[model samples]
Target: MDNPVGMDNKPIARTNFGSNFKIIPTNDQIKELQTVIRDRSTSRSDFVFNADRLIRLVVEEGLNSLPYGDMDIITPTGETYNGLKFLKGNCGVSIVRSGEAMEQGLRDCCRSIRIGKILIQSDEDTHEARVLYAKFPEDIADRKVLLMYPIMSTGNTVIKAIKVLKDHHVKESNIILLNLFCTPSAVSMVTKAFPLMIVHTTEVHPVAPNHFGQKYFGTD
Candidate 1:
């Protein structure tokens, strides 16, 4: 896939993050993303519906980043077919309310995949993120993890979440961050902090608007 071009007219690959990041490359995916962004100006229901569609695209892209193994399957016609299967041990970890929005998309893509939750909130004054609660599959350390968070603006929350995963013995390389939108600052911070981690997103905005979640949830 070709590198995503940022609003500044530069390739996303020039951000110094190396190959640890991927942006949805298809025109159809980009078109859907634009539709979701536009729906933000309409009713909440419209925004949610479109947002879910975009999330599904990103989740599917994230799943593609996971390791897969080859297998032989018997088709209905009794013919041998070679197929690829996701590694056995895998799970999804949502970063909380906003992240939970992507759970359905994850489930739709990976049937019966285990899900974990981590609640983190940023301090109003300090802007630092703190984990309020976290739950993960007991075998998460051995499973490839998809860390779900719709927006990565400051990256502090993602950093904290990764720390929590590390505390649980989940290797950095095994974690894939699935996001819908992000800023260059956020990408820089995340990739610098965790070079081995992979970040998959539908778009990278030059600047992350403060009202994204509020607008989507109709609280703005």
Candidate 2:
């Protein structure tokens, strides 16, 4: 918990938070599978597989940070082809426990990438987010950071975690939240707290699959 920045990244933004929110497009099949994860009758094996499949899309999009420009290459025909280049100084920081579940999908997207961890828990008395541990790349300030947490409920944990990053000199614009499902309240609170921050997710429902970590890790 070195240099924890108390709470919050900056003054809440007065602008609309919706513009900063990005949702992964879903079709009928994707929609049906999303429902599968929330069904209590689903078994652990099924739950883990389907959940992984769905979030894999989100993970890829967030990691790729898509639709690049400026780089061009030549094919065998000698014709120029425009393409995207993966930016250097990119790293991921996952909030421990539940957030750890999204780690593998991230690795799959970037094989040699470095990953960081931050462990935040709620104080029993104060009911506030408390950072117990944090570790990041030495040059994290220069790197684009992805906060890999699946679900956002009250958003207290995420707000606190972002503060920790800001303390270490990570710019709000350089940070992207990779989430699977979040409520409108969670989305609004987080986007307002750090307006420049970007959020990528699959769905924004009234209820998140909060049981995600428990079931994904087989704790249930």
Candidate 3:
């Protein structure tokens, strides 16, 4: 019955994105979000609503990590001061269906944001993420890509997403891996493969073994 007001309190960490990945929420809040999403007894409606709320918080927190510039401002008292403005070199792209589920959250927090869509699905046998669809703006290379995936299990989907983004000429530092739930192995796999890529996840669960000994999760 809690209002989900503290989802943005989850802790964050530094990966490959330099100072560009700074939204760090807390571990406690991350766990809370995961618990709500994973609870079998929760109604589908509640699940979707709560998950959306959490995703909004995540998006807002992520926005805070973006690079900013200083602007001159005059106060009501006639004093001059420097104010921070959001750096405008980034774009957001969500993995279809589940990833798109977070799109409204991103829109609510950003002004004049451009959203791209990619479809990646998990192979039932291999548990790998295969890209079924992708479409991006021609100017994507000039903007940071907020690659969104709702869950990070084996990291295959996100990896493929990154590959797509890179093929379009987007720099590694310009790609941020954003997810709702992630496993330690998933984070490690992506970071080890792409050191310059930064990741922002709500929570990291311990490893869960797949049929082929690979850590995996069920994605609908």
Candidate 4:
């Protein structure tokens, strides 16, 4: 981890940790994915296939951090072994449109995972977003939530989403922001705003012109 200067002229570690924000990707993995995605010659289909695989890997990585307790188990060779169990069930919520692309991977990785939806649109004038629709199970407060939104170039939408979850009593630590792409500025924004929420992004670009930049491989 490295330190960046802040308004107070003090050193700040470059990671976000709080009740709701956590970043999941390492610099190496993110760079590899970015190289593949940025290749103009890459076929759209192939690009998507690889992206989906990468997303699955990220989901699995995040799951490994959840609370787990060891239990005695017998191996196939009749040897004693230890295993872990999920402390609680989890929920997956997508930020609509592009987020839908990630649902399949999350579903495939988690058994009978509950899916939630949040629809947010940006205002043409203020550049702020309004949540047009949202529906999450009443039990979401108790479950670990996986929030998905692709290409987080700007932190506005995701920040609003976190606020909504908090208002509903969901702890920031229980929320994980899953995505395929993000910018350094956006990462800094979310990490600074909601340090506890883990962010699992496949790639980090320098800074995108808009929330959805031209090079971003997303469904606008």
Candidate 5:
């Protein structure tokens, strides 16, 4: 199949990040919003609010990477207007707990989209990601999947989740990972392993606010 069509604006691919690793272009507004969430002194309410704003942006960018088909529709003026339809079905799979935080943003765009869950935890000793629970749509194999895992640090958890998707017959090329914050090292690691998969993130930094789940959920 042809590679998933990236955004018309195109995803920025820095030479160091390699191809298929798309960074959402950021501006002053995004920078300030990110700063609010990243600041340790920020209140939980502000953190969650600003975080959702960034997540929404990342979600929109991820949708742009999916394939679409052109269709002309008659407008109110009785004129044919060109429109586009998604090429195939899409379902979301969120890494349990943390990834669930992004579900609302995805739902905002896809009101009735199906979403699945995978629970993975890192072993304290080896620090390797282990999948404990997973539940997916019966027809996940036929749908384009948006894997929602906000913060990608070591990339171990994402790689583990991708393995599960592959076992379920989801094509590597058909999956789009909707992420908000990621470290450059983590991006490099994930891309090296799954070159065909698409990853859309707002920014790539050396360090990520891994406590995002706790802050967003008021657990911190």
Candidate 6:
């Protein structure tokens, strides 16, 4: 497969990870992100609102990749109908702080869905991500997991999170990454490390913002 052209007009690497790697095809999503990034005057509330909207789309795209089974149903007209039903037993696990931003979107998509959290921060000196904390459901091994992380820069944090999931017995093929933006390098690194995993995102950027979380949260 040919690499897709990103905003910088550079070729973004394509992954052999699986059929689940998806980029939401929506100009509106791009527009919203541009508004959030280019408008330095954008208030924190407004930025969060636009970001959440985009996150909802990413979450929906991720959920669509989950396993589904066809079933026969009866409609209001008492006619037999054929429909596809999502397989039950799915869960969301988010890398804390930035990743938590996508959790509400997941809940909106699937009410009462089980959610887990992992806190992984980068070491200031080494710049490597290390898991500080993790909390997951006991039956996580049996459920399909949607790993939420808003940005994929070096792919270090995400890789660590995936390792934690694997340690908890989550199957590699059953894990899907829901991200807002990802760099080509990050995408390649992640797919190469876990070829069976899926990655779903709104856009692919050539580079990540220097202080994405800080800027968005008005902490910078």
TM-score, candidate 3, is 0.78
- Candidate lDDT values, in order: 0.85, 0.82, 0.69, 0.71, 0.86, 0.82
lDDT of 3: 0.69
Q: What is the full ranking by TM-score, best candidate first?
A: 5, 1, 6, 2, 4, 3
Q: Candidate 1: which stretches are off by over 4 Å?
A: 1-13, 26-29, 38-40
Model 6 over residues 14-65: C-alpha lDDT tens digits?
6553565677775865666756854778777877777778888788888888
In lDDT terms, how accurate is model 6? 0.82
Alpha-carbon RMSD of each model: 2.1, 7.7, 6.9, 4.7, 5.7, 2.4
Q: What would the per-residue lDDT of candidate 4 be over residues 17-115, giving only the tens digit for each residue?
A: 333333453567655665566666766666676667777877776676567777889998999987887777688898876777778888887768888
Q: What TM-score would each prediction reach against the true structure?
A: 0.90, 0.86, 0.78, 0.79, 0.91, 0.89
Could you give candidate 3's per-residue lDDT for residues 1-220 as a string of tens digits? 1111223544334344333323345557655765767766656666666677778777876676578899999999999998988888778999766677777788888868898998877788998778888898879999987777777678788888888888889998888767766666677677777878776655555532121111112342
Model 4: lDDT of residue 134? 87
The residue-by-residue lDDT of candidate 2 on 82-200, one tens digit each, is 88778578888999888888888888888888999999998767759999999999999999998989899778899999999999999998999998887767887898899888888
Give candidate 2 misplaced runs (Cα > 4 Å). 1-15, 64-69, 76-80, 124-126
- Candidate achieving the largest lDDT: 5
Clashing pairs in 5: none
Q: Which lDDT tens digits does candidate 1 get at residues 56-168?
A: 88998898888999999999999999999877999999998788888999999888999999999999888799999999999899999999999888899999999999999
Q: In candidate 3, which residue pairs clash?
A: 9-25, 9-26, 10-25, 10-26, 11-25, 11-26, 12-24
CA shift at 203, candidate 4, in angstroms? 3.3
